[model samples]
Target chain A: MVLSQKLHEAFKGTVERITSHRTVSAFKEKGVLSVTEFIIAGDNLVSKCPTWSWESGEPSKRKPYLPAEKQFLITRNVPCLRRAASVEEEYEAAGGEVLLDNEDNDGWLATHGKPRETKEDEEDNLPSMDSLEIGKKNSIQSIPSYFGGEEDEDIPDMAEYEEPDNLIETDPATLQSTYLVAHEPDDDNILRTRTYDVSITYDKYYQTPRVWLTGYDESRMLLRPELVLEDVSQDHARKTVTIEDHPHLPGKHASVHPCRHGAVMKKIIDVLMSRGVEPEVDKYLFLFLKFVASVIPTIEYDYTMDFDLGSSSR
Target chain B: MADASEKKPILQFAPFQSVVDEGFWHRLSSLKLNKLGIDDSPVPISGFYAPCSHAQVSNHLTLLSESLPTEASEQAACTSSVSLGNRNKCSVPGTIYNTNTLEGYHALDKQSLLKAEAKKIWDDIHSGKALEDSAALSRFLIISFADLKKWNFYYWFAFPALVLEPAATLVGIKPASQWLSPEEAEYLSAACREWRNSNLTADVPFFLVSIASDSSATIRHLKDWEACKGNGHKLLFGFYDPCHLPHNPGWPLRNYLTLIFIKWNIRRIHFLCYRENRGFADMGLSLVGEALISVPEVWKDLNSVPNAVGWEYNMGKKGSKCVNLAKAMDPTKLAIAAA
Candidate 1:
């Protein structure tokens, strides 16, 4: 609908009121046009202008980019607490093989028996004992008796009897081949597609941006709220989380509370303020969405990707 | 200049505008002061701190006293007496007048008092009581000032109100009181004209979709419209009664809608509602059209007629009559008029 002059004036008035003087000045000092000015000048004009420079320096020059380590601490899988008895039982159940170093190391086996010429030849010569029964026996024998004696020598050679060569070789060529096989364009791998369709709509009730994440499960089915919960960080999921019916979609969806969005935006504004720049209110949302996109890379949000700081326009 | 009684001299400094070059002050003095029959004296280049209006000062004091803790209030009261004495010494309403000397006239004391009061009020509001009392919450919103040169000041003002407050209540309070200056308004209008020109010549086609209520039938109708028109061109949707949606919070609808339009780079809008719903039309028009003018042009070209389409639905007949809002807006045709 075409805006009446009066209504137009009111909106303009609100924009003017909300525009930050500090953000604008900061933009000017950096020799870049304000977001509002960039918008008003049209994309063509803005594209022609010099790009905005960050006060800390160019992103590339700010700090050296460290490649992510291939093997880092997997905190999610680490158990915070464990019972001593149960842990001891688990260790014993593995036939004292649990404490063995990297599978490549042969020290643990050296104490048990001499290395065989080949795994197949060793397996052919070993007796086939009932694994479960042996495990049960090992657990019982693992506990030290109160009336101590030479129990260590009496313990059965469970490790030598069990299957040898259980550890797979980790040569670089084999590792690379395994990686290639996992990522190969197979039907099973194709079926396990990971995609998150993100749409940003306003919650009239909250007056804040409502981000909707419609993710596809491994089987390509629409994910339920409970399943989606698994994708969110545990700390975030624990906070005032709710599963509301989607306004436009078919079923119940998880709506993340945008409690942190404003603070994050404020931090960006603070950065701009420190640099003596005043950004327009309209520009805050745009910059904010981009900042958040880095946190949740799988979800494809609108406008966040289109913004080009280098070109000074979308 | 004659007839000194007709014109009152403006001795108060405008710190926000004070940073303007000497030429600007000279031109302002020549054009404005000369006509008022007052001395065309140049505004001082320096020594002026931030200026606070009387309403702001009084509001700050009231907020400080009511919201501050008892100990803080007691401390403030002790300080208030000293500030009060200083204020009384210079009783002039807008300008600070000094009895000691002619050049000593300055509002520095009052300005400092206002700043201290503002700080205390900010601390108290953020201390947790603002969430309980609607008045305190609204006061927090009022603190988001446009005239402040320091961007950090506005950032601090907006942060708590925007983040901490419940979304249900935050939408009800309007956040800002300042209006666009004449220069800003003119620039915005010119930008709108440029945007319109650029869009008119672009290769892309634009569609204006109208939404009235949030019913299954309404959704079906929108789907049909999209199916019919969303083939080659981009479809831009606008609502007439967005508040009618079951979950709508009512406030922030305009800004949010405008944001969506800009984000999607929508070209035109159709504000659809019953014949009497002027409120919905006004909101739709303000957000979809006026708000976009200040920003970049989203419309490809201006060849399309009636950039703003207003639809009035007839409840009894289950049909809507569309009008070209580019021609004229008739409030009598709004849905509210039928009632």
Candidate 2:
């Protein structure tokens, strides 16, 4: 009868139907597959979905409702809204979660943190790392005033998430120094191709003081800085892409990496819980699997330090 | 009458000092370029440099930065400062014209065969020649940023994908596509941990994304992507990868991905590539709800568009040579059964 139990059962069914690999239930004995969800008012975000994106979390939670760049559906039906990049933190500072601005005959299309209106201001459409899109149209200038933005009318359920505000805190130099700009132009001069390169390296000695040594904690340290870049030199840009290490997603020295001991495993475990999986089982599975997989190795790890968090034995 | 001021010539930093060369500054400062200028250039950041001597403008001074990528360190080697030269007019390399497909995508450094080296390293790794100490191994690689760039060494680091299929499956997620292979599934599951730790979102598609008209639609599509990308099983995200998607069940997975933006007074396309935004645009947001064609495809069909830079789909019609990139179509929408 409990919602968590229902979610557990539903996730089990979905996994059983779709996956051929081992299930959380099968690995339950190792204690690594626990489920947690965020219940916002009424909707329950069932997160046991094994996807690696921000969308993998329980949507119902009010705090980290998968920011706009990670909304589940671009439609009105699943209204897990987000703020426009520019005004996101401002809204957060105001303690707002859902942007209940969009309106339609369905009363409210969806609350995506922007006052639904005409897309008149060109300033609102500028592309920053944090900015989001109005549609898949990909042309900034071509985007019309909220004139036909109500085009989501075909879907009766889609609460049209009104456009959001653009966050304003930016460094003119940091923007250019990031090396994110275009060199070519279209016939008409609209941005047809853009390339971006951003690198932030860290120190070799990366160790965290928090979560120092909880006997049961499965934490480690990171010892290297990184270089990361993401470029969107699409086919239209007719340019060459130089973002080879596109997904490393490395940050400057000020970031946290667990092995180097940043946040306590328990804290990360808490975030994981909000995503749906129960931490107890997740850790148990990690330790158990580590134990099971270590059978034939020349030397087994001292059961004391669990380095690979993926191992059930950790 | 202000010729005295002109004679003394109090120099002001160029508005887009980061982008403009000495000639550009000279042109702008002398009222040659600013006469045709708009207030659209970028502003300067802190710790900016100005001409120490007007005569030294063209000559670059090699000043080292005390700022390291990490906390300020005593190690001066890590502290970098590039003395940039004036823009050299190297006719965009011929490779620009030759690169027509994904296989031939241009790399910043293309001297060596990266794939071959990656394969050899992988063989050594599999055969236990890889140093077991993971941290030391990683540390060794970190210092060689230029080498990695030169060798196209992503293959060296990405061997984890081949070895760990599940994580690899999540490597290049296509938005709203079918289930991933077990290897890919596990690979992606593993990647999710890194992705989650890094706080990655799908809609924040920097590497490759279709430009949008408004922030609302861009955010909407981004939320759609961010949600799916965090799923350990997601890979190769597709926010209407303007190059691929012919239709749904495979294309832009936002099940309800729709045309939310309308056309405005936007008369021409602008590739606003300064720090603010960078991407493609149609002359007038005119190409809204039409056939899903890739840029390469458009490029191949020179007559496809009446514009100078011929835009075409990556995958062309039957009997067409592979002049553009390669893309797979979803049979569900594009498949034609022989009657």
Candidate 3:
């Protein structure tokens, strides 16, 4: 298994090098970014999405090629209310419609299968209908229902799991009779879901914008690396997500392996172009976030915005 | 009142889990090497947390690049008072005692250090300074030894929580959505959203919430409690709760509870555990809990500091967490690994 994994890494590395070689200076064609282009795109993202801001990382660790402040783009405390597995289950249960069949060898968009029933409801409620992108409506609709349905049941069970210190002093009889049976029908309970501080840094190796996630548990404790994996979509969990040292930030963070990011971005851009939307290099992060959403669907980071994609078809 | 028939659970708080960023240690290493070669003094550092933003996850007091002093020459200034518009980063004032040697770190009087830290919080609570900035109630301490040669950092964080004598009892606890009427929840959510979005109040970790008979809610600073009490319809002590557990609130509430009981002479209080989802006030994730407290006789003197118990647990023990970042941070290893 280890040998196969090593082979896979080697193959991925070779593929990335070859693809990067082909699209040396091309952002639209190759879907990879130069360090300069990354800074421009980061600036554009920050201006568009106020939540995303440029951060100057450790002074000594700063890449000489990148500007001091533009070492990374960070948006902290992004909530992930549900596991991606739950989204997959719900989508399957709803008889999810495949928006686009995977034509490109990089079939990342195949995971874009979403239930269409909630689209009209979202379209009615959202005032900025023009800003609504094609695939965003479905996943956005899942958030509220996910909160309402799952949150109620999770609380009473959690109530039973209090600090042992609180329980020890109490009489054994009272503990048995009062607390264990006192599972009052807690319908109105807080959804204690995982939170993530998501960041993006330019990867010189793959020539792609790499995404990193630092997740915290309900009690603000750092989630174990394995626990962090539960939030990642099953498709990319083991294959694409790896715990590595964050380029700018301190400590190891779960990063979406950037080896196939360029290929995936290329496929996404082509799909957009076919739909009469001209993708801009500056708007790359937006597209990057949209695709990253498939890998980490439940992390409710602000990625969708009212950027004009120059869609003549619309 | 340990009446077996009517025994209710005593209110307990979940201890804080510290997350020291890689940059924090890296910066500390630089400081140790360049600025203070052998000086072992308590350095004031800033720790950042937001209102619990996720349903299950509590917001950790995260040490970032901005947590440490930037300049080697200048004394580290407390940046907790300066409100950065980012609602996600509410700075809490903290002190870090970095020792020269591992033996020195172990030799340091931990009990007295914790007492000293807790006394600062106690002083702030009594002097009405904590009312101005309740972030003072969440004062934290760190004792660390940076092994610069090995790039190993042995550190432990203590978020000093003043123990309430005759500990607070949980009258009732439930989700804010269930506790408040739809209209009341709506008004409270709107008020909280406004508070979180504002540049000034966004970083204020603690505040007072007054709900009118008409279900109109207003969020005020802790200092405005006197003003709020006069016009109060229904008052709830609101704080940026960092715990999402259904049973208990986070560690910050322990000191806040002490402050409310001792300072305000409040025996009973309805607290709003202000949590958020997607940057908006999430009433479902937020909690409303009623706690009853009796002021300890010792607190009447106002001179004696209460015994605190908030040394952060590492792997379920009262121990320091060590991080070896040599492979990740060393330039030679990085270059070799990259190749």
Candidate 4:
């Protein structure tokens, strides 16, 4: 038994080394991104998605290899309106429709089901509001369904979203500001929900973007690790999502373990290639975020907008 | 007037929960080893908190790596800039009294230290310094003995809140959405959002909300209280509440209440417990309440500092908290554990 265990360990090391090599040089062949590609993808993501900005984090904790000002990509205060289980329940109630490539993974990648209904398909099926009276409510409610269908298309900048009525003229000393008011829900469902500060750091060991989540409860209080786990998909909650010291930030955050990130990403790339869509390294974060969305289905970060070009949605 | 049953309940507040990040401990350990050798002087640190965003969770006064003084001559420079427009992290000035030994920590007069800190807050309120920089009203202190060798830390945090004799009575409290009309809620929400988004007022925890006769609301800094008065508009003393309890405000409000009572001499004050959801003002989570304070004779004296009580509860008990970061922080221990 000991000998078998040793053999298994040695085999695992060999596989890891081989995978690492492939990830290092073959960003096009394999889905994994190199350090430079990660930065390039990050810059593109930040430039495209105003919500996703570069953060230097703590000066001492900043990775020496990475750029000083751009150690990681962070998008703070992303509202998680519902728990993953609730979203899953909604899907199951809607109809137990399976949309992911692999059925064996259970409902892990079931998040794709909603975004799978392409923006064009949604526009074709759902009628636009004929009345401006319902425009604001409809626009806010349909934020999740709104996805950028093309890579080149600009993601709707939620940060800059301002209602004319909500705009206030400030004193000349301060700049004009518009606040996004969290409106009371039309439905009786509790408007209070958790928010997550989602950040992505390039994991050198895994050669993939590592996603970290710092969740706050409806009252803006920090969620403990166990509390954060409730939002994570059951398939990955304990297995992959472990609370670790954030590389840049001061506190421990729930990070999706990147050990199998390369393998899973490679599978996704292969599936994309089979669909005759040539995925590029610059769009790696988009695809990476899509996979991460599978793990955390409720964090409404700015990832849903950019993945429509290279991947086949249901 | 009604009978004795009509008396309103005394207003209580949820105390601030101190959450020291592991990175804070790591930095403290480094500072203890490298810079602060045998010197156990009070090191000025910063604490960060935002208005409560969750309905059931109280936002912690978190100490991060940035909280500590970056340089060796940190003694001269404790008061840091509070103009950081990061809506999520409003800076609270704090000082850490690190003791050389556990005995020294225990023997330290907790009452005197707490009293001295409360005096500073009292002085700030009276001297009008807190009006200019509202973060001064939320000053905090920590007494710690960092066991560098074992990587263990024994610490107790105190957010000194000045008490008001005959504690403020709650007249009525409810969700802002319930209290304000639809138009009023919408207007107030927008006004609050603008205030939070601005670089100058984002970190200012306390402010005045002036609602015009036309249902439009404008948020002004506390320093502009005189300017905001007698404008023939409704006024609310608004603060960034760190508490999520439906009924009570946070610890910051205790001192804030004292400040209000002393500064403005307002007896019945309508206050806004400004909470947010997803970085925007949520009227459902935000609370609008009225606090009626019966000023004590002692408060009449400008030189007097009222008694305070704000020791943070540790593990649901009234005590100090200890952290054992040796497993995670010690390099030798980490290597050995790895081996």
lDDT of each model, Cα atoms only? 0.26, 0.20, 0.71, 0.71
By lDDT, the better pick of 1 and 4 is 4
lDDT of 3 by residue, B215-326 (tens): 9999999988777886748999999987766666777888898888878788878898888765568899888999877665768667888877777764344566555556
Model 1 residue A217 CA deviation in Å:
3.5
Query: What is the iRMSD in Å for candidate 2?
Result: 26.6
Q: State the C-alpha RMSD over the true interface residues for candidate 1, after superposing those residues.
A: 38.5
Q: Which candidate number would show the highest DockQ if scored against the true structure?
A: 3
DockQ of each: 0.00, 0.01, 0.09, 0.06
Q: Can you tell me which runs of candidate 2 are displaced by over 4 Å?
A: A1-264, A267-314, B1-339
Question: After aligning candidate 4 to the native by TM-score, how far in Å is the CA of A310 from where it should be?
Answer: 16
In model 2, what is chain B's TM-score? Answer: 0.16
lDDT of 2 by residue, B70-163 (tens): 1222332321322111111100000011121223322312212222223333343333332221111111000001111111111111101111
Model 3 residue B97 lDDT score: 99
Candidate 3's residue-wise lDDT over A179-238, tens digit each? 211222242222335567789998876789999998765433445455577788988898
Under CAPRI classification, how is model 1 graded? incorrect
Candidate 1 local lDDT, B201-238, one digit each (tens): 11011123322222111111222443535444322232
